[model samples]
Target: MGSLCFNDGVQDDRQPWWKAATFYQVYPASFKDSNDDGWGDLPGLISKVDYLHGLGVDCIWVSPIFESPQKDMGYDVSDYQKIYAPYGTIEDVDALIQTCHERGMKLILDLVVNHTSAEHEWFQESRSSRTNPKRDWYIWKPPRYDAGGNRQPPTNWRGYFAGSTWTWDEHTQEYYLHLYASEQPDLNWENAETREAIYEETMRFWLRRGVDGFRIDTVNKYSKRTEYIDAAVTDKNSPYQAAPEMWCNGPRIHEFIREINQVLAPFSAVSVGELSNTPDPKQVLPYVSTRARELDMVFEFSVIRLGNGDLFTGKYIYKPFTLSQLKALTEKWQCFIEGTDSWATVFCENHDNGRAVSRFGDTSTPELWRASARTIALWQATLTGTLFLYQGQELGMTNMPASWDISHYQDVEAVNFFAEAVASRNEQRIQATKHGLSILARDHARLPFRWNEDDNVGFTTDSAKSWMRIPREKGISVESQLGDRTSVLEFYREMLRLRKRFQGVFVFGTHTLLDRENESTWAYIKEGFLTTKDGHRMRGRALVVMNFTVERAPLVDVSAALGCAPESTRLMVTTACGAVRGAKDELSAWEGRIYCDFGPEICI
Candidate 1:
């Protein structure tokens, strides 16, 4: 929440607050629990304002806390205006908003308009009868009859949580579409009434409550291919087909986004869309482009999908990826955003993704774990975009231990996938699926936040069991790392501080990836200009080098990478222990360093 002074010791009013801000994503259920109800609530988050403020985060994006069945962990909203009872009341949220702003921070709720819970009044009314006026509010289609005279779903497209995308409604004698879980029915954006209701009831209702903006959930899935044709079979094991093209970024996506933008413009709000299934930068540009006037930025999944399997298996089936591949995908986005009006959102871990340290860092040994965690922190902090840090990421929290069985997972996606795998009755398949889930399951990120090494990791009191499994791991808690200079949490603080110190270079600079083919190293240079207080302009560049392997990495020429002399560069920060002797000929295992040549006066 602290002001970011870019150049000349003056805050850059030209840039939007979000353009250079660091956002912290709080999974309400896992963040903290103050009521001792085994679930985290708004009051618990309110208690941590000082913690977030100290971490240098400017905005907090809380994943869905609306009234829900919690079938999808709050993503399935039963009521837009009401707060989930377990999380807290509307009054608690108002207090949270006030608490955040009182400390100079902003709060943005998760806008999940793509779907509503089956128990929602709107969906209940829509399904009451075929002639109901709200029947068109959701995507409802008559079941198709097969040649054998058996009823089938409207189409053969698979739902995101597995099974057919359409669920049969016996009362209405029709099938309703749900891109995700059957409990979450997709809204028909083609209906003007539905769109307007979302804008007025869901969006405006919160904006009027002083909420900054929204992190739009499934932003690109608002529109769907109305043809209702069968999708091509991408996964032969399943009867339904995996067709993102049929549901993601469909015909009317931009129109819907423009309409939402109009709603946000009056409030001067910022939006970061969760744009899925559109990996191509060209496809992503329209949503975030200033000329398009859609969203402020977007969360693209190309880099996150590096080691993921096919669309159907997704992260549940993991594949190995080289550092070169990660560098290429990252640079592709970084280069694509340069000079364009469109902006980017940089993140590794999120509510749906596995822990960043487990996925991107070496967690085999304690030493490697801390080093790799710090290395990933440096990598993310130096990227040319708005940085989003997931809860517990700063403390190097990792995925649950491999010994944990399928019962530990509370995520609907993981539970469904495991059931399907077990139903297959193939031991090989079940074991492989379980192994993959251990490495990449969404449940890993949903574990209760480790506040300390207390019972239930200090997420709640010992009398109340956490809603989800608390990891048995030790030492990766806020209390444990609070003042330890060598801890991953401390490294994150230093990295964020350095990022603020060189905001001009880190935020507005041009990103250039170096050693494109290097498998053991990831290096990039950020170049920009900063003006001194006395009206003197100085050019600055930062060279970031990271060793992504457990083995020592080959030497990287610091001077050649940044096109500056070695003497002019200063060792800004490093993950390696002891004082670094300028630029070394070789980097130790899992080492990361940042070198800047912005002059002594400005670098400090």
Candidate 2:
């Protein structure tokens, strides 16, 4: 195969190991439970290493496993070095890492350095006295007093969890900043000592434990320009809303990331920043740019933003996104990041969003469920980046049952949003509001893993309860899908194997969208040129076509588009439904196919 450098002249066909890897995100709490404690532990995760190995995952990204007060579900880290007791001890983490290595899989832990639990020893000392050495470790400012001596928050900024970004502390007579929950105080990255301590305690410590890397949470929020400025108000009713522009990708963000990168370079570790606040890929490029020496990649969220709605109403009250929109978004990122040292982290589902099938595809019936699952999975794997598959994704999991009420929700973000929406009744009508909240809740993804069809769906013993209610979806368990030849799990295995077989084309090839303007049909071409075993140059191409709707969509006539007859395209991977034959053939709802062909038959 011919080797080519990206347009930027820095990235070539030769990429890092992570660039060709497939990742599985395990939300530890809901992954699996051992010891009947109603919570998932490291031991539970260690036992599943084989399961992951069989799933063809190159890496497992375990969500935050640090010590905390359980507020914000472990994002609020009290101790950077200790594992949360419910999860297990440090030795368990070591064992898990070693086990993953033995299984030929890498482990990447969640790094929540943007904020620390208020109960952290440093925060405790900082609040104890104004003169404390650790006082500057957290963002602290004096309250703004009115003429009548009434105190207001230091800044008119709301946190991600709602309410003020600053919390008043009577002992220190000041307010500390928290971009997220008040219990999770933002760390002062401006302080050299604070940054150094984080390196030694979190990054270095974990690297020494033999962990591969980290998924840095809220990484773009690490640096904030020094100012007590009030953010522009789009909604007068919520004037103090958290200002992402002022804090996200702040002036020193790249510098700090480079510093962290330098420390990680020696260990040969990789990091993907959770650039949650960055809505534009342009804003994210620098952080992952090879020239910047920062993160290896960053999570771009344009696709997820499609399902979201008004800030107050959340993602539930939204219009359906079209295939054109998905195509445009993916191509936009692919075009921008193709040649640069920067890479993309592509995923359609995670612990924070509703299940992909429920949110992006029709799941009202069994056939639609599988088709929808396969379509999204095929599209994700064919993209030009690292692929992250959330647990149960391969099993074609749907969202929480529509009948579940507020009591069944477990994620703090969803639960708090429900209460806040109800309390702020004037914002919208009550009944319609509750319906939307239930559909958009994050708990839909946090439910326990469905292992089999049993009393607890095989998540736990009959006598043992789960930390959160486990919603039962018949035939969606691993046990049910394991041996089924046409099941979603098998489909995923085939997709992965095919990807591995055509790694050069899928991972390093040039990506081109063929039907950017078509709403019902999304098609793309991935092609690469490589040297054959006998030293002859060969070109391989994979044409991916999908029907994003339930109704049959007319097959796109690629004869004119690609200058190749439809009969010449060989079916590679597809849904259980057979491939289309003629130029005007139609596809079943959610049906898709990847056709393998040789040469420059398809235009790049």
Best by TM-score: 1
lDDT tens digits, residue span 378-402, model 2? 8888877788899989888888788
RMSD of model 1, in Å? 2.2
lDDT of each: 0.87, 0.79
User: Lowest summed lDDT over 10 consecutive residues: which window, candidate 2?
Assistant: 1-10
Alpha-carbon shift of residue 593 in model 2 (angstroms):
0.6
Worst 10 residues of 1 by lDDT: 1-10
Residue pairs with colliding backbones in model 2 are: 1-530, 1-531, 2-529, 2-530
- Per-residue lDDT value at 514 in model 2: 88
RMSD (Å) of each candidate, 1 decimal: 2.2, 3.1
Misplaced by over 4 Å in model 1 are: 1-11, 579-583
lDDT of 1 by residue, 1-604 (tens): 2333343233456678898889999999989999888899999999998999999999999999999998999999999999999899999999999999999899999999999999999999999998999999999999989999999998999888888899999998999999999999999999999999999999999999999999999999999989989988777777888888998989998999999999999999889999888878889999999999999999999887666677575546678888898999888888787767778888999988788889999899988898899899999998888999999999999999877778888889989887887888988778877887888888989888999987688888852577887767778999999999999999999889877777778876778888899888888998876655555557688899988888777767778777778887787888887653223687888898888776656632
